[model samples]
Target: MDNIAGFIFLCGLVLVSATQPQDEILNNFQQVTKLSHLGLEFADFFQNVTLSDISLADSRAPNEEDLLCLRDLTLFSNALKERKLWALKMIDAWGSIPSGILTGNRHNLGNYDECLNINKDISQGVTIRGKYCFLQTSLSAMLGSDIGALGVVTRIKTATCFPASCSAAHMNLFVSQVLQKVLNLDIPSTAMGISDASCQTSASEPWDGLTIFTVVLLSLMGAIVAVFTVYDYFFCKNHNELPAIVKAFSARANSRALFRIVENTSNPNVISCLNGIRCMSLFWVVFSHEYTGRFFAANLNLFNVLPWSKLPFASFILHGFFSVDSFFFLGGLLLALIALRTMDRTKGKLNVPLMYLHRLIRIVPILAVAILVYTKLMTVVANGPLLQGFSGETACETGWYWTLLFVNNYTNVKCLGHTWYLSVDMQLFIISPVLLIALYKWGKKAAAGIFVLIVLLSGCLFATMMVNNYSMMFFQNSFSIDAMSNMYFATHTHATPWLIGFLFGYFLHLNKGKKFQLSWISVWSGWILCLAMIFTSIFALYPSTQSNTPPLTTLEESFYYTLTRVGWPLALCWVVFACMQGYGGMANSFLSSPLWQPLSRLSYSIYMWHLFIQEMNAKSSRTNSYFSDYQLMLQFWSDIGITLVVAYLLYLIIEAPIGGLDNFLRPQKKPAGVQKTSSYPIQIVSDQKVHGDGPSKLKETETIAQTISE
Candidate 1:
């Protein structure tokens, strides 16, 4: 009769698997089976096992997939309660009773997977916990309620199995066998997956004592600044005693400044083409970071959904990386142009110290403020599964000095990850004075030698990177952070564009005001070649950006990295040269448009805060899933809008005020004997008045033109 019953139970198991629709849980178990190597009938083994021994450990009651895991665990554990032979079968299948848990340093034993907190949760507070992630919640406590696991054997050698030692041999055999078999059956992996699932919490950590304190301090300071700014802007009547705050953010003053910035041909010493290029580059950066900024966000499954090679025409967005080169190119160009002009004005001499000081003054104040806010604010306002250990204060606070010192690119420490650009640019500025002085004093022979040296150094560096298989990316393209630290972010490797910019700037400086007479074909061809170089540089990495395509070979990577970095900057020089020489047609007009002036003014501040806004958006995301293009675009726009407001505030309070404070506080120096004709990188002036004591005010453009006169 017992044999018939067992045979009938076996038939029921076969019938269920054969007739029922395939369950996803069962599929998971099957997938995990490859790791188990257990040779047994899953249906028969499940029939004997039950889940009554389950404990969510300290985890809250399970939900969705987690609930399914607990349900399955209970089913397997319960089956072992009645079937003695099944326990031996499980022992044979798993090889032995599994020990330990899947927490740190114990993911695997010699041959079997561990059954982490199942036995221990009975004594802990294993109640039915609701689903709310605490800042310090343990992984074991999130799966469900646990009474102790049911005893598998009532007696061993006719003694009661009360304290569990009497049936130690059988219980160890049965429990270990059951746990091992269950882990083999897909329970441990499922339970372990709790670590990967998206988690969120609305409640703030009270232990964030420092965050609260910082917020209060910042609030008080902000209120004081705000009140003072308002009073100075509206209430202060005397121009002689004008506060810098009124001069910086005052609506009446800034309105006139904005108008001057947008006036076509207003103070045309600076190439208006730069306005468009800077603005466009900044927008591209925002667009690119729209997707890449989720370094720690939910998977967003972009590689799967938006595979790179498969796209028909919009791959340029992926290559927004070229924009950084454009910036570097522009930096080198401006540095060479201004340095040469300053030396020419100063009798072939440069103020190396003042040049350095001016650059530091331009870049550091806003940077320091942004870092301070990012480190302190993130802990209070945001927290998410992806941001668990990466975002906010911990990512950057210790390394503020490295960034301030302009050596951040060489260090593994990062306060704001994006600040690597600031470090690189600052370092380039520090070094540029030496090169500028050399070129000014030494002439063309020096230029030729330096040019050749640059080519050789760039070539050699790229070759080494490719040979070492440096990932060449701060993103998925990199193999390791160590490699990215040494290769991608290094000043030496990225200096190619900066160096090239100097050459272009020198060329433009020498040829300024010279009219060129070229045939129509020559003009057209120059434009074509320029366009081709840019398009090719931007799109060169299209094939490698996707997951399906194989990684670029060392030769291919070396060639493109070498060519593109050189090509993009050279193309920029052409645009500037052609425009100045009256050869640039539509490209120059569009680039030189006054519409870009305001955006250009905001570009640096925008770049600084765009990533911070992106992180905030990602952490606060309502959907804990892969990002789709539609979703990203919407957030991208939202991020831009918010960033603009924040950037404007930063510019008013910290950035624009730097020059104003100096102008307002110090005794105005009389026009330092006809200063050289050069475009200041940041110059917002009124039609008649320059800010404070700026460039003799109403006569600024005439003065600039006169200073450059031969």
Candidate 2:
């Protein structure tokens, strides 16, 4: 009897595997069942099933065996089965299981459009259309792969076509029943699931409340911009009788301000090198983000990133975080220069409240607009499997208020996580008046005290890292949330660079007009040292990125972190000092070029919009990008081009207008007398006069400093 049953089972399997003239559904059912060893009962169940037997509208509860066969046939069809094998094959050769399995196959996105466009006729009035669904599964968990030891969940893509009427909820139920009851295969809930967000019968999604709100808000803003633009062109040009609000919001006035660049022939005090630094730093930020965004999105050769990072030249990309430190240094430097100058002009009377208010005005409006666009409009912009996961709209929804308050870094909520720098900057700005006031009152004595304080703070930072075991290098395998929170994002940990810049600013102010004639050897030595410090800070961790290198000890990490934090800024300070003192030569010429002025002016807007553009590009992509230097360079240029155009519009529409409005609203003081001619030659360029005395004369200076600081 046993021999007879075995023979019958083999014959049944052969019969099912035989080529048949049938519809795609029947064909898929045969192909899927051929791989299963479900004995005579399962084979019998599928053999009897026909196109007419499978009704999407049939509400009656299916038999356990029948439902299992149907679900398997629908999900593991010929196309999807091929994709699964492709995914495994792509990653099989990779040495690092974490890198390979974590990202899965970038090319595993099965023909989504083809599936969605399927409109097959089952019978005369009964049509069975295809619904393309994205099913995410953990290959590591399913195959019991050792990648689970890395404590990361593996999300591999599997896509398939089902009947249009079979919704995600129904599919989920079918999968669960088949796994638990029919197959008796135990799987974790997190290991496999259907993505309802990715299931699609068509491209268009029904408009929701957030979409409507975003559209209306954008439309209203556009109407306002149009009205003000027309008013500025038709009426305000000829008449000065209109309200201040009209002039402030004028697109014409704002665009003019954005494009206008004045070279200060007389301002020996102006740090012209800052323009180049700001522009280049922003470019670095954008470039790094472009590469990282691809890593987060689907990259077919993601495992290659680890090997590429080991290269010496790769430090430029890997160490891009130093660019952010450069901004912090600039912020502190500009704050000291402007505040001290303002104090000198006002004779020791500095308006602390106004300083805070001005900082808020410079940051808040455009930031609010960015947050709104991210939270409300991103969903309306694109659709893809990656979009929902990577867009960060959900984080924005809950944490936007924290971002507005400039304290999101401490909290788990991060609307735009990159804006953590803004929070740190703001906090530093808030407390700076105490130091500024002291420096103004006591002069050199206060400077000595502040230097001592910086030293103590540096010691504390070193101690904190040592105690917490924070790694010096970011985004390495050993990097953790604890390290990021304690060292990377902490305000106190960053104070060393800011304070270093502050001292440099004060030194520059004190020696503004004094011509330092250094010997040729001294100048060359300074340049070499400056270049060495900067390069070391950027590339010191290259060995750590190499495959065979051991991880740095806690003491080594702390020492490197402390040294680099201070040394990097000190190197930058030398560049600025050299440029200002006329020893910069070709370096100064490049740094102080007029070409950098426009980009420097637009840097704030670029910083705000660059990440959004990068994210949008990454998330909206239907196909996985090939990871290579050539591809990255191409994407970088594309991202930067889009960023510049958007940043220009944002600057004209928001940043410039708000700045003008701020100037208009502030109570203007009449000129006291001819501005006291100090040894330092300061140039002021605006619609207002440069030589005008009192607070009014400081407007142009204030605006210039604000641009640098932002």
Question: How displaced is residue 7 in candidate 2, in Å?
Answer: 30
Residue-by-residue lDDT tens digits, candidate 1, 436-528: 767887878767876996798678777777778765533343456566566567778778877887787777667655678888898888899
TM-score against native, each model? 0.68, 0.80
**TM-score of candidate 1 on Cα atoms, chains taken together:** 0.68
The whole-model C-alpha lDDT of candidate 2 against the native structure comes to: 0.64
Instruction: State the lDDT of candidate 2 residue by residue for 1-710, as single tens digits.
Output: 12112222232322333454557536644444444222223323424445354543247766654454454455334323355432222222111111223223323455555565566443476444566666555545544555532323245454555556666766565455445544566666455556677676654667778668767766676677779889888877553455667766777766665566766453677667777776667677777877767764677766577677788877887677777667667767766876677667667676667667765776788888888777766756755545655556778988899889989868887888778877777788788888888988998999999899889988998999888777746546567777878777778888787888788778877776778899999999999999999989877887777768887888988888888888989999889888887899998888788777666666677777878888888766756677888998999899889989988877667666676677654655335673432222222212111100000001123353332222
Query: What residue pairs clash in candidate 2, if any at all?
Result: none
Please tell me which predicted candidate would have the highest TM-score against the true structure. 2
Off by over 4 Å in 1: 1-131, 134-203, 206-217, 236-245, 248-260, 266-268, 294-296, 299-306, 312-314, 383-388, 470-483, 541-552, 664-667, 672-710
lDDT of 2 at 113: 54
Q: Which ten residues in a row have the lowest lDDT in candidate 2?
A: 689-698
Give the alpha-carbon lDDT of every model: 0.53, 0.64
